[model samples]
Target: MPSSSASPPPPPWLQPPFLLPGFKPELEPKIEPMNCPSGQLEPFVTRDTLLFTPPNPNTVPDEVENAFPEHLRLAHHLGASSNDHRSVISAPVVEVPAGPSDIVGSRKRKARSAEMVRASIVDTPDRLYFRGLVRRTRMTYDSLRYLLLTDDHGRGEAGLSDEITRRRKARSDLTAGALMGNRDLWLNRDSRIIGCIPGIRVGDVFFYRMELVVIGLHGLIQAGIDFVTAGRSTSGEPIATSIVVSGGYEDDDDKGAVLIYTGQGGRERNVAQQRSDQKLHGGNLALERSMNYGIEIRVIRGIKCNKSPSGMVYFYDGLYKITDCWMDLGKSGFKVYKYKLLRIKDQDEMGSEMFKLANELKQNPSGGRSVGHICLDISTGKENVPVSLFNDVDNDKDPLCFEYIAHSIFPQQTSQGAGSMGNGCDCTMNCSMGCYCALKNGGCFPYDENGTLLRGKPLIYECGTGCKCPLTCPNRVSQKGISYELEVFRSIETGWGVRSFDVIRAGTFVCEFSGITVTKQEAEQLSDDGCLVYPGKFPARWIEWGDISDASPDYVPAGFPSTPDLSFSIDVSRARNVGCYLSHCRSPNVFAQFVLFDHMPYPRVMIFAMENIPPLRELSIDYGVGDGYA
Candidate 1:
C-alpha cells in the first residue's frame, strides 16, 4: 500500500483560484500638528533692594543703630528717624510635633513603588521565547549564534568552523540513529535497549538545527540533536554526555551549575561521588521541568513557493521543539514526525485585546440607534403596499415581519440588521444623473439639489415642485394632506437609488424586512433551507420571491378565508429591485439589505448605501459577495 502522503494532488474544490488585479495606489492624507498657544510667561524672581543685618550680641543697640545713616537709623523714643527706619522682619516659628517621620518614610515608600513598577515591567520567559524566534527567523544562523554566545548582533569568525563541524557530526549521528539503532555498546548491551543511545545525561540544554527533506511524497530525512544528560557508571564515576544524535545536546561550559534531584534514595555512601554527580547535572535545580523546549531556525530567503498546482514546495523558517517521533511500519513508505513548542507569546497575543474590546463594544449599544437596526424598502400602490400603509399597520405578530421591524427600528439591539435604511425614487427623466423628487398631485416637485436626496433616491423618493402634476393644490390644507408621492421612471443606469430623509433619525430603526405575500407552506419550506423569497423579475434582485406554484401542497395564504390551491404568481410591478445593470465603480452610492424568510439557521447578508452614487455606478453588497476585495 502507498503512503497517505503519496496520494494524488488535491482536487480543485480544496483550493480556490487566485484572481489578481492591479494594485490600488495608496492615498496618503497630510496631517500637521497644531502649534501651542502664544503669550505664556516665563518664571523669574523679582529684584528688590532690601538687606538686613543681625545685631552683634556684644555690641550695644545704640552703637549698632549709629553705624547706619539717619534715614536708615532705627526709630526710637520720638519715632522721628525716617519712614524707611522700619525693617521687614521674617516670621518666628513655633515648635510642633513631627508627624510619623514623613520625609524619610515617603522616600522609602517611593523607592519601593519604583521597584514594584520595574518588577511588573520585567519580561516573561514566554516573551523571550517569541522575541528569540522572531530574531532567529529574521537573521542569519551565524548572526543568531553570535548574538546568543557573545551577546552581540554581529557574527565572528572565531570557533565558527568548529561549531559548524560539530553540528554536522551531530546531524549525521541523529540521522544514523533514526535509520538504524545506536551503535554505542554500553547503551545497547541489554535486550531492552530499543535503539537507545548511551553517555547522555537527563538535564542538559543544546541547540539543534536541521532542514527537512521530503522525497517522493513518502520518505523524509531529519537530522538534529537528541538528549543531554548527567549519568554515572556502576563504579560511581560521574559522567556528563549530550545525546546529540537523537534530539538533545549538552554544553560543556554549563557544568556544575545546579542540580534538581527528584528520585527516592535512602542509603548514603560516597558524598564526593554524589557531589560530582550533582555537578554533572548542571542548571539551577528545576525538577520535573516540562518536556517541551524551544527551537529557532534561520529564515530561508529568496525561495518562491506557489500555492497552486502540484509538485510545489513551501518553506518557512521558525523555532519549535520536537516533542514526539514515530515510524509506522503499517503505513508503508511513510514516516511521521510531530514537533511541539510553546507558542510565541508576543505574536500570538498582539491583537487579542483589540478583538476582545471590539466584541464588548458590539454587545453594549452606546448612543443612538445602532447601524444594524435601520431598514429601507420601496413600494408601489398596486401589488406592493405603500410606505405609509406599511408603516400604519404593525406586523409584529408575524415572526418574520417582527424581526424585520425590530431590526429596522433598533438595529443595534439585534446582532443581525441592515446598517442603513432610506427611500428610493425613480427619477431618470428629469435629471440625467437622477432626480430626487417623486410624482405628486399629477406633477413633479423639486427641493434643494445638494444631491443627498438624489443619492438616496434609489431607496425612496418624493415629488418636488417641478413634477408633471395635472392637478394644482387648492389650499395649504389640501397640500399638507397630500404629502405622499408616487415613484416613476426608475433608471437602470442610476441603479438602485435611495432618498435621504430625517424620518426616524440615523440609527433609530434596528430591523426591517420587505413584506411580500407568500403561502404558509412556501414560507415553511424556505425556512427549512434558510433561504429568502423575494418578489421581482430582475436577475440581480437581492432576494428571490416565490409564487403559489412554489408553495407546498398544504400552503395557505395569509388573511385569506378559503384555502385555495392556486398557481404560483409573482408580482412584477410591485416588487422592489436593486438595479445592477450599471457598471461598477470603486465608489458607489446605492446598496441593498436582504432578509431570509426561510433560513434562520444560517448567517445572513446585509447591505448599506454609499455617500455618493456616480453615473452608472454599480450597486453591491460587501458581505463576501462578488469578487471579494476587488
Candidate 2:
C-alpha cells in the first residue's frame, strides 16, 4: 500500500512528475478578472467557449503560449484515469458604417419614377403650357416638365386662360378700327390704289390705303387741278362729301382751264383746273434782194460802124454816137462794151454818107477801097467834060497796103503780109520775069515729074508748038476779063481783078480750099489750136490761079512726100498760111472739120456753116482743123 498504489496518476491539471525524482512542474499563472458591473468575479472567457477553467499544463503547447491570453485558456480533469480537457481558440470579427451618397441615390431613383407617372397623366392643355414654358425659357423639354410638375399646381390653369383672352381682345380691336378708316384714306390720295375692296380687316388695310390717298392728293395739287371737283369716282364713294371742303378762284384768261364735277348723291358742283395747251404760224425775202439795185441789161443788134483817123465812128442814126475808140474784150468773142455821146437830131445827117458806105461794104466783100475804082467828073470852061482820074496803077506792087485797107473796112477780115504766100503775094519770086511768066514757067507747073501740062500751065500743043495765041495759051490765061461796058484789069502777081460787080454778099461763102497740112507739133503749139481761129491774116485778094512760089511758101505737100511724081494741086496758102492767119476767139462764127484727102496733109480744112452774122463782120475759121501751117 504505498499510498494507494501509485498516486493515481497525479492529478490531470498538474504536470506528470518528471520521470526522475526531484523534478518540479512549471505552470502559467492565472490572470485576474476584469471589474464587473455587479461586482461579481467574472471568469475569463474566450470566443471559443462561454466557460472559465484552469489552464492544462500539458495541453498548452510551448510555441503558442505567448500568443494566447492567459485568461482565455482553460484546462479540466475527468476521473482518476487523469484525462484532460482544453478550451477552443479563435480571432475576433469587425463591420464598417453606411455612407451619405448611397442614401441620396436611392431617394433620387424613387423621385424620377414618381415624375414619369405624373407626366403620363398630364392633359393637352397642361402639355401646351409646358411646351410654351420650354420655348420661353429656352430650356429642354425634360427641364420644363420638371418645373411644371414641381410648381404650385393650381396656378398653371389660371395663367393659360388669361393669355388666350388677352390675344383675342387685341386682334378684335385692330380689325374694327381698320375697316372703318379704309375708304376715307384711299379716296384722298392720287396714286392708283389696289386691293382696297370689301371683306378686309380694318387695321390690316388702313395703313396702305392712307399712304396711297395722300400721294394722290399731292399730285393733283401740283398739276393745278382741283381734286375736290375732279369728276373721276373712287371706291364708289364721293371723296368731297367724305372730307373737308375749301373754295378757290380760277383765272378767266387761262385757255387751258376746264370745269369738272365731283361728289355723290346728286349734290356735286363744278371746279376749274388748268391743262396742257396743244396749236403753229410762213412769208418774199429772195425777190426783194434781187431788185434792190438799179443795174439793167439790154441786148441790141444791127449796129454799123467805121474806122476813121480819129477813132471808130458810128455810121448809123442811133441814140448813141461814137465819141471814143473801140476795144476787144480779150479773146471773148463779144467785143468790149462801148460808151458813146448822145447825138443831137441835127447831127444825124452827117452819118448818112458813112452809113451808105457801111451798107455797101457789107453787101460786097470787094466793094471797099482795095477792089473798087473811083473817079470825079469836072466841067472845064463851059463845055461839060469828064476828067479822067485813072492811070495805069500797079496795085499788086503794094499788096500789103491794099490788104490793110480791106481789113480796116471790116475788122473781122484779116490780111497777109508781103512775103506770105497766101493770096498770091510772094516777095521771094524773081521780079525780072513778068509775074505771069514766073507763075507759069518757074513754079506753077502742075507738080508733075515729066512736066506734063495741068490746070495753071500754058496749053502749048493746042496752039501749035511755035504758034501761040495769047488768049489760048495757059501762061497768058487769066481768071479775069474785060466786059463791053468797062475795062477789067487783071493782076498776075496777086491774082485779083477790078470788076464792077461785087464779089461777095454779107455772110456769103468766099474762096475755099480743102487741103490744109500741119505738123503734129505745130498743131499742138497754138493757144486755142483745138478750139477757135479768128482771122488774123487773110489775103486781100482771092487768087484764082498761081504758082507755088507766088502763093505762100509755107505750103506743105498734101500726102506723104515719099509718093513720087504726085500731081495734086491746091492753094498752098489754104494748106499752110490761111489757118495760121486766123486768131483765136473763144466765141467764133466759123467752125472747122478735117477733110481727108490723098495729099501731103491728110486732114484739110472744111469750114462749117454758122448762125449769127452782122454787117461787115469778119469771117473766122476754127484752128482745130490744123495748126494753120500747111
List TM-scores for all candidates, in order.
0.15, 0.18
Candidate 2, TM-score vs. the true structure? Answer: 0.18
Full-model lDDT, candidate 2:
0.21
What value does the lDDT take at residue 285 in candidate 2?
10
- Among all windows of ten consecutive residues in candidate 1, which has the lowest summed lDDT? 109-118
Model 1 local distance difference test score: 0.19
Model 2 misplaced regions, further than 4 Å: 1-355, 358-580, 596-601, 621-630
lDDT of 1 by residue, 31-121 (tens): 1111111242211111111112223322111112111221111111111111111111111221112122211111100000000000111
After superposition of all CA atoms, the RMSD between model 1 and the true structure is 35.2
RMSD of each: 35.2, 74.4
Model 2, position 325, has a per-residue lDDT of 23
